[model samples]
Target chain A: MDMRVRLTLAYDGTGYNGWQIQKDGLTIQGELEKALSRICSASIRVHGSGRTDAGVHALGQVAHFDPPPKFLNVPWNRALNAVLPPGIRVLDFARTDRKFHARFSARAKQYSYTLWTQGAFFYPQRRNFVWNTGPLDLEAMQEATTCLTGSHDFNCFMNKGTEITDTIRTVRNILLAPGFTPQETVVWIQADGFLKQMARNIVSALVQVGRKKLSQAELKSIIQGRDRALAPATAPARGLCLEHVTY
Target chain B: MDMRVRLTLAYDGTGYNGWQIQKDGLTIQGELEKALSRICSASIRVHGSGRTDAGVHALGQVAHFDPPPKFLNVPWNRALNAVLPPGIRVLDFARTDRKFHARFSARAKQYSYTLWTQGAFFYPQRRNFVWNTGPLDLEAMQEATTCLTGSHDFNCFMNKGTEITDTIRTVRNILLAPGFTPQETVVWIQADGFLKQMARNIVSALVQVGRKKLSQAELKSIIQGRDRALAPATAPARGLCLEHVTY
Candidate 1:
């Protein structure tokens, strides 16, 4: 009998096209499948919990796969890493029940966005990991998050091209706190599910509030209006990371 | 009258060849000179405090150049960043007297090396910034540093190809401490002058001591041996960073 195995993946998405297997480009899934197949000596498929856009990193993205029974007892953590590239790794692996699906069994996901809010030029070591935004009004950004928390019809935050009609998502909170440096701020958002570009779009609105270009009251009205046209542009992809996914 | 201008640089050396200008490679100095020459409408020469090997990063590497009188008032902090690639950044700048040389007038320098000493894989985001060594004896590594502190004849620690006969220099200390994660250790080494691959050579020996292959007393013997062949191989350059330079 074969058992389902789950793997927690961490990757610097800057080098890949995205998380999905695409015909024309390199991706996190494609790399995983290639490495796994080589180790198993057979065809292998990988199912990620979800897709991350290009340049979006992941600290703990989950995936599940059914491996050949002969390979079940392999020391996966070290075995996978030995064959994988430097930009990707298997952080942890464990046996799971057949009912456990990488996507449908997920309960919530959390993402963190980094903003270098102090100066025109931040440290070069973190250039790929942050959005440089000079200086921002921290208080206004915090106030904007309060309104975005909890369950809401976030149609306004979804990308205009996305076809999802039911756009409600239960955003637990948007925690804004200082990062490694005082001038840097990391915004963490936890939600049951995110619509296409929903988290980035929400962050765009909060940054607008921080800039004083949009008021907190205006943000509330935009959600009630449910018009994507009224929302600000989607934030850049490099600043975002899939921090964790809870089942 | 033309005055000397000092510039503090920060760069992710993963992309550039090194700190010096070379005819065959894309180097950090070559890029800086190109950008400055374009801005000044004349060829500009930059003098770094020292050269860093390929793949070594810098948080506060210092450099100096004499600017034309007409361009003296240029807001160099923002101007340099506007033209340089994302990998290189000018953190600070100021006008200085000709007596303050970026190379000759330096007092001391600090470098840091990161090691992920827990598992086969570390966070992919930090893959380029750390040396992944599966579990090391922390106490042994700390003990080895005791014999290496202060001014001494470090001929054994210098690289073989280096021709410097006077190898005596004051090594302030090498501090090994816990990093962001419990399993990660960061080593900070401060010195008045670093010989070619001296910092890396010291770390290689320390790591060997941590593994129990080289005891603390054996390290002392190696120093006494004063033979470059007796020293361990130099550590990888990616894990090293020129943290600071004080004048």
Candidate 2:
């Protein structure tokens, strides 16, 4: 009666060290494993779809784990949520076949970055959830995203020191939309895969273009050059969120 | 020359004691005074419309202070916001007549209390801003509000140990509406003035009616009884917010 369970998680990453298990800091993976182990009364391992940097939130981060038959009768989602801290929640859970894998079964992912354009004051409630950058040229940023669509070698947007040799990523779309507030904007990017710091770096480059510090043609050149140093510095991790994953 | 300035303030009260200045704990008033004093190079005292309880938020809390003429050249709102912590913000500021008083000139005030009915989990970002109660009978609550409207002595709903003797107050309206989330509900109450904890106690009584623990006629009797001991416990301060103050 052993079953593999797939769980969709949502978490506020303000206090987490990221999705991976680290020895010195708190992490999403560490908390999930501990909660699952406590609930099942046995050691449990969870495999996440991917690693998110420190301070990056997630609304639909998927994971998978195997549970013994005795625990299967319990309402797993509610049981897990009761033990988890308020910052992390299990949004959905279901039994899956043994062949299903959280990381390998995912086909695409989407990330959204929020920017507060108002300079007069910062919203206290959203202090840890958004990037407060005073005013940007919206038209310029929108035009810059046009060039970012489609498949490209995103090595320039990737963080240095990463071991992945394949720098290519297929960007399905790049969208800029109004956020919940009038002074906020959301940048949503969908891609087959992302390199380390790729989403944040891409946002930084778009911001530079909006600020008129880098021309559209220069952005194109930077991507073509495939040099990380040539692009603008990576945007802060707080503004980035893993919004969805398409399987 | 001294110029009286009116400031509309907003703050997330998660980290502070309350709006009043307290010796042993951090408070919104203390922080505002410190920021204003630093900006003006002198000790500045601010007069708030009223004091909000510990953990109560505000969207349009009004205050006033006199500033030296030299400081008028500075953008007061922007300057104060720069120095204030992220939890507090100055939403608006303007020079007012010497006769205008933040506390005395206010005609009425509006307060809103948010109740999160979703029992599945708590929202981390809103942990300090909402009351997490499971589902309630919205229609029953609405019916119960009918007994709470109009001018009356709200002694039964008032928190004990207050020095104010007169408890008669005019309630302009009591509104119950759906909150931003489908699982949440908002209670908006407007009045000439509210005694300490009156709004919260009222809501608590209404919730009792919603749960069928109390009847509408019994709620009317509680108001007529005018005895604080006869009423239900006051609702948590985290759910209450000073939404607006009318001049």
Candidate 3:
């Protein structure tokens, strides 16, 4: 008998190419499948809640897979963790109904972007995890985020190469809050779904506003324009993290 | 004219061999010297407060050097940080009198060791900076520390191969405290100076007491014995950090 297992995972994305399987580079999915296949002595595939780009970390990413009955006796969470590298961890595991699908059953997601506004230097430990942008006008950035909240056609905020027909996304909230230090700022966004590069693109536009390069009214016009060329470049992948996926 | 300068630095030890220059691989000293040489347009050498072993990090490791007077016009903290790799940073810099020496003038030093008691998994971000020891008896470890504090000959804890004639050192305090997370514990030790591997070796013995392999009485006996064979093995270098140096 085959049983469905749901796994909640966390990872530092410094070493992996991305969440998807790629022929030329290492990926989170590829390493996971390899470990599962070795444990069960059969080919295994895992479906992730969504794909995260290279260098994008995750605090709570959901995935699911079917395992043979023979492997059911093993403590999967511990066994899988023992085999996985230190950069990735299986935070929790449980048996689930066959109807559960990681990608299809997800209803919403939350992402957070960290910006280090400290001038000159950054802590060595966090150099790879946060965007070091010297300094920013937080008040201007916060005001600009208000223009991005609620339902809108996010075509201008997505990667132009994506072939998806639907560009509409419902942004539940956009929050800009102070982090642990005076120079640190965290931007958290919750949404029903995100198109390719949507979150990063939005962050880029807000950063422009913080730098006083674009006004809040111009931000609204950029969204209304519905043109990807009108928006600023996407923010670096290191600052963005998939914080949670709601089922 | 040569003017002595003091530098307060921080670095993640994941990439370098250690604080000292090494023939086989990259070291923190080598990188810092290279950057200084480039800025001064001449060969440069730096004297650190002490040499940390391989894979040991630093939060406020101090150093000093005299640069050519012409080079003093450049902003060192900003100039060196711009040229150095992301893993190392010059946190502070200032011109000091000729009598100021990073090593000889230091009055005390503080070292911290982090142990993660979380079962089954380690956070990816801290995987290299902490010891994932699962669980430890805090009370036993605290009791064991009392025996190791105060002025004493730490021959049993120092690395056996070192040729330093005097093993006498004064330990001002040893603190066992909770870390940021419930499952994490931190051990902070302050002393006039440390012998090679002394901090790690003491931590190893305390861990042995936490596991009930040694009693507080035996730990005291180990110090009295003044024999390296009487102590437990040294802890891994990853968990140790040179936190600060006072001058």
DockQ of each: 0.66, 0.44, 0.55
Share of reference contacts kept by candidate 3: 0.67
lDDT of 3 by residue, B45-148 (tens): 89999999889998889999999877766677899999999889999899987799999999999999988877765677677788888778889999888898
Model 2 scores a C-alpha lDDT of 0.88
A169-231 per-residue lDDT for model 1 (tens digits): 899979998775566899999999999888889888988898999998999999999998999
Tens digits of lDDT, candidate 2, A26-132: 99999999998888878889999999999999988899998877776677788888899888888888888888899999999999999998877566767777898
Model 1 ranges with Cα > 4 A deviation: B178-183
lDDT of model 2 at position B2:
53
The numbered model that scores best in DockQ is 1
User: Least accurate stretch of 10 residues (summed lDDT) in model 2 chain A?
Assistant: A119-128
TM-score for all models, in order of appearance: 0.94, 0.88, 0.90
Rank the candidate models, highest DockQ first. Answer: 1, 3, 2
After superposition on all C-alphas, the RMSD of every candidate to the true structure, in Å, is 2.1, 3.0, 2.7
- The superposed Cα distance between candidate 3 and the true structure at residue A20, in angstroms, equals 1.2
* Best prediction by TM-score: 1
